[model samples]
Target chain A: MSLTKEQCFDQLLRSHDVKPEGKSAGWLEQIRVEALASAGALNFPSAKQDDWRFTDLSSLFQHAFYPVDSIASVKLADIEKFLIPDAIRLVFIDGCYAAGLSDLKRAGSGVTVTSLAERLGDLRVEENFGRHAPYKQDAFVALNTNFFEDGAWVHVSGEIAAPIHILHVATCRDAPSAIYPRCLVVIEPFSRATVVEDYAGLNDGIYFSNAVTEVVMKDHAQLQHVRVQREEKNAFHVGHGSVKLGTGSVYAATSLAFGARVSRHTLHVIQNGEGAEMHLDGLALIAGRQIADTHTLIDHAAPRGRSVQLHKCIADGAAHAIFSGKIIVHVGAVGTDSVQSSRNLLLSDKAHIDTQPQLEIFNDDVSCKHGAAIGQIDLDALFFLKSRGLTEERARNLLTHAFAAEIIAKIPVLSLVESLGRTILDRISGVRT
Target chain B: MINKESRILLEVKNLKAEVAGVEILKGVDLTIRAGEVHAIMGINGSGKSTFSKVLAGHPDYTVTGGSATFEGRDLFALAAEERARAGLFLAFQYPVEIPGVSNSALLRLAYNTLQLDRGLEELDPLEFDDLVQEKIKVVEMNPSFLGRSVNEGFSGGEKKRNEILQMAVLEPKLAILDETDSGLDIDALRIVAKGVNSLLSSDNAVVMVTHYQRLLNYIVPDYVHVMDGGRIVRTGGKELALELEARGYDWLRAAA
Candidate 1:
């Protein structure tokens, strides 16, 4: 007999039912119970859905993943390579906080960088948790809201010079496990900070990471965020990001996706107050039967809002990359200026890309422009480089590197930029097409 | 500087080429010696640019039948970049812009590749910067141009000047300038011409393919060949350019 949608979700939640749970705050427990009911009510999105048309989740659903109940051994040396120097770190393993591996003492006054399990009673967490990220329509967000136990909680009231690194490492396990990595960042009025949310895996083992990040920017707050996901090659990654901008606030984000068998990131940004600005840049470099999908929505709800977005995908070796961007201007949001461009590079004959940019403007005084381009390397440009004595291979490599460097140059971190540049160069050197 | 003992730099005999199965160059012949400059004047669709592209091995044009010898070697045997490393340069009529690649990076890479081919030491960034700083003066370019993307957002005159700047850096043995002065103003034309003249030496030669005699006035050619109907109909001294400018290509077209 074919199992119903609720029955399938029961298999996913069966393990959580057997585990002993700690007593949470009254409001937080109410949220988890409501979210569990929502998860059971929401059907799993299939290829029939518009957003899941290009991305298939059948492979991910074949395994009934159990939430990790036990702490897996992870050493500091294992995660040292992913650490950024002089930055405050809060590390998590298998969705559980690792206190020994994390450094939290360096955070200054009026700043709190700790785990959500510890800050359950904090007013900031109580106010913003499960509020910014919507779970009614998104099944993955509902699943995360139901199962997530611990995550990074950062609140900045004053200027913080050092970037905060929220590192999540998924350890290899024999049983198919599900890991929920959550992050909540709140920047108070006129405060500024930078944060890096990095997700990586320990070994090439099968696991599932359902992550959610919610960012709240107050009036005149400025934040620079960089999200990097390089999961194990055999893992499934689904991430959701929801951001709300206040009056005169600015949010600049750079998202990079490099690894995972099949991964999808859905980011939604809303400019709720006047004169807010948003910059969203993304790059997805995938190959070898991999699929990377990015769906973004930017809403200008107030007057005089501005946004600029550039998203690029490089697909090779039968890989598929998808980008769908939508911009909305509310009826009263006049004087909104937005530009979005989606560029793709297919390095092999079998590689594929699907890009769409849509703009919905309700006001006549707004300015919006968007374009999408997908093709191989320009032959004339290749010949020009060759005529300058560059070998054909070197010429192709240089052109591909330059195509990716346009977005990579905007990243605020210096060491990450250099390392990512090297990664791109190394990948392009082996590309034959 | 033309002398009888100067080595033959390029020899094209009865060359034929076509693009997309349509013949554009039918049995064209030309010859150039070291320390010599030759200008080929033609009207539109006269196969002058085709000859330059065919020699550069552009993928679009296929050689139906041709024989080209550069420095006593079969030029067709080498790839486009191999031909470049062997000292054959083709300055495009319309220089292509490469976005996101800096100007100095391309110049340095091209210079180092040729240096490696010639068994010379390659210069690092500092040394290459010193060399490029000296070469930028040839076209009177601002040092800031090296930091921008190659040829991106450059004016017509600046593009032409950049082509000559590349020519100066490569110092090719046989440099073919294809309509290098087409969109240049009088001032840019003089600067480009002067840059080319400064690169000329006893061991190198140049072939300028143009429609007007304006560029020839700045750096006079040793010989001028008037081409019509895909073949050279007349050859003369530098005065032939003046004659073509004065009488136009109608006379050559009628004869061919």
Candidate 2:
């Protein structure tokens, strides 16, 4: 029998086997139950909604998704190509922690990195878990909050030299299923670290991955975060990331979306104390029948807050890319300075992009500016390269790569930057003339 | 410097072209030979730049009539890159800025492409770096300029120097400098002229399209042609440039 939307959601909710085991597990269990109740009350965002106006979720609801029942056996060699050198690796297979493939030996001093399942009862995990991401109205976040089996929990109390890499590998083999992967990163006062959250698919399978990540930065803490989503070509991914900054803290984030048939990511960052700085950079390079949507909101609630954002999208074939950025300087946010820019490149006649940058300032002593530009390959630049003995195709690809390098160069990780550059070059090499 | 036995590098015959359906080059004819440097000087509205662009096969200009041949081969039969591979180059007055593409990368690619055309092995990055380091000395450029984006945020003189740098690497047989000396100061102009003069040999030729004779003062031309109303009204020895510089282009326009 064909299932309805509510029936599918109910089955997904019932598939999770929640069992409170140890000290403070009851508190965690209570939070999960309340999230479950919220998930039951909320509905999936549809095309008629304001926030989801450009992204259509009707196709995501067509497939009946159940929770992963067993952990697929993944070998280290199977994931060897995805490993980053000199990084503390945490591997998860189908939303379940895979200890055999992870490297936790190099996690330097004053840092705690483990599976969320292991630290559920700890005071540090309990204090920030389910605290930052708003799940009351968002169905995806609520679903993740209620059903996530395990996740990566990183706590930094002092400086960490080695970067933390959370690798989430999806292998949906048995049936059409859903995986909820969550992460909570807490950087204590006066500490600094770098984190890389990466998601990849093992095969071309139809599945769903709903992810939620919450980051908390105390006073004077600095962090560099990079999120890369490279799912299979026939998968669906919805991710929500929330960040809260304290006084004198600095946060820089670069999000790269390159895969999946349909994907959307929402990032919300708020400066809750004075003199906090934030830099957000995003790039979506997709071709074929892909849709990548990004929505961001930066809220400056305190005085002397500063933020800068640059989002770029390069679409080829029949792909569609959407970017919506909103910056708000609340009342009494004096000396707030913000800049936002959106640049899009359409490589084919059928490719399309929609970019909207909005700013709301409530104070007189603030400087805010935003601009968006959508264009094709610069003909003059192409001619310049061609006049130097490069073929038209090579010139076009070179110009396209140059367009994307502006954002990829901002990534703090050298290895990631090199790999992303190679990927973009390879992707654009096959661009249809 | 003319040699009677010199092979013809480029020959133009009453070439006519237009942009946006407006005629810019009306019955323009010029001939360049190996071991020679020719300069075409004219007033602001004369078709000096248009004639050079038309010869380089710019897409915006339509070749309505006449013909151009390079080394006895039809120049119009090849694409822009093909013409470049055939040892033809144009030094743009305003070089376009290409952000995110490193200067070394573009130069190396252009160099390797020519190497392959000549049936030679391509150089690796290390080897290419060594070669480019040697070539940058021709333009007196800093080594750091090779690592920056192509022409992005470069000073006007620096952009011109970069053009000469490319010319040095490619070693084209026929190079048409279209107002390359317009934005250059005296010092930069001397440096650029020195680079071009060093590259000239008995086997290749140069065509300089300019409005002033200041550049010719350094890279002394073998012949100077006065263009007026989209045509070369007068051709003379190098002394013609001196006469036009002393007496403005009005006398040439009136004579035409």
Candidate 3:
């Protein structure tokens, strides 16, 4: 018999014991209980649901994934290729902090970087742990909240000289397992920093990674957050990220999705103060039977705020890509300016893309625009390239790489751009690098 | 300046082609030889562009009948890039705009591929940069254009100049310029024509597909063929362009 959703939920609940520690144990235990209750009340999203219509999760629910409590065997040398030499690294193996593999001393003064499991007693952790990501609405968020063991915690008071790299490495043993990776970032006023969250797996297996990340940008703070998901081909990954911007704060985010059998990302941003600026960009390059979905929401509550979003998808083989973006301007939010565009390139006839761009405005003074385009590589462009001595396949690959470079160029970190470019090219060319 | 001693470069006999199951090139017979320039002129819908595309092996056009040979080798047997590597170049009427690909990179790739085909030394980036800079002077192009994407957001005249720049870099044995003077001011047309004239040599041949006789005034074609209903109806010397300009293509169509 197939495992029922309720049975799966019960199994998850019984798999791990709650071992709360430090001064914030009571608060943490209360949060976990409330999240579990929420999870119990809400069922897994069905295909009938409008938000889950295109992406079916029946296959994901059939897998009996246990919570990985013990540390799985992983070599630091194997993950050394993904490390940035100039940045501080925080390594997580199967949702638990790997202190032996991390470089904690690289953080300079005015910055605090540590694992959330170790700093449970910190007051800041209690204040901002579940503030942005509401668990009641999303079952995945609730599951992550109820089951997350440890994640990276970063606090920046002033401009940090180097970026912070958080690596989530998933390794499976004999049985299929699940990992809930959580991250919390708080940037104080008048500071600037860049954080990169990279998720990768060592082997191919049927696993689940439910992740939640929350970021808080104080007044006049500037932050660039980058998330890269390159998991095993048979794994399932669902992530939710929320960001809150203060007065005059600047927040920019870019997410690159390249792996997994089925991957979905939800990003929410709220401009809480006046004159805040937000920029969101994403790219998904998937082939084979994989599916990648990206959903984003930006709320402009303050006046004179500006936001720009550009999302692109390149799907080949029988792959599918979905992008839905919503921008809301409150009644009092006048003089708001926003632009959203989603462009997709389908390399094969079997590939598919669905794009929905929405804008809700209560004020007439706002300037908002949205557009979506789905097309194959232009035949004329391909012919033009071929006439210049390039093979048809090489020309198509070049155009596909160019389509993705538009979003990859928006990355703020200069060093990351080249490597990301190479990775995207390799993905398009079917190279194993 | 036709020399009998020169070798035949391309020979097309009774070529017929169609696009979307509609016949466009009924029968286009033409002969091009080294050390000569041929201009194919006709009214709109006269299959001028289709004939050029057919010779370059465009996927949209299917050659229904007849054959074309270049240097005694079957031209129809080769793919588009293979045709290009075999020293056949076509300057498009409407150059495609490919965003995010630098013009210099495209040019260098074409140059290196042709160099490899010809067993010549391929230039590296540093060497190719100097060579491209020297070639840009052929069309009086700005050096900054090399940094921009291939024809993305380029002006009409700039796109034409870039095409000539490619031709200059590749140095093809046979080049067909389709309506190169379509959307150009007099100064831009003169610059483009001058670039083509400078690239011409006794070992190479040029075929100009044009609507106006103004371009012929600069390049000075050795043979001008007027095409109508997909066939070359009239063949004459350079003065035929002057007469055709004086009395438009309607006169030739009516005479044919």
TM-score of chain B of 3: 0.98
| Candidate 1 residue-wise lDDT, A1-433, digit = tens | 3345455567776756855585378888888888877877776787888888988676677666777878888889999878888788999997788999998777899889998988899887999999989877788898888788789999999999888989999996887778999999999999999899999999998888999999999999999999988888889899999999999999999998888888999999999989999999999988888899999999999999999999999998899999999999999999999999999999899999999899999989999999999989889989988888999999988999899888888888887888777877877786311
Local accuracy of candidate 2 as per-residue lDDT tens digits, A328-401: 99999999999999999999999989998999999899999999999999988887788889999999999999
Interface RMSD score of each model = 0.6, 0.7, 0.8
Q: Once superposed on the true structure, which residue ranges of model 3 sit more than 4 Å away at CA?
A: A1-6, A17-24, A104-106, B119-122
Question: Once model 1 is optimally superposed onto the true structure by TM-score, how far is the C-alpha of residue B64 displaced, in angstroms?
Answer: 1.0
Off by over 4 Å in 2: A1-24, A431-433
CAPRI class assigned to model 1: medium
Model 3: how many Å of interface RMSD?
Answer: 0.8
Instruction: Output the number of the DockQ-best candidate.
Output: 2
The TM-scores, one per candidate, come to 0.95, 0.96, 0.96
Model 2 chain B: weakest 10-residue lDDT segment is B50-59
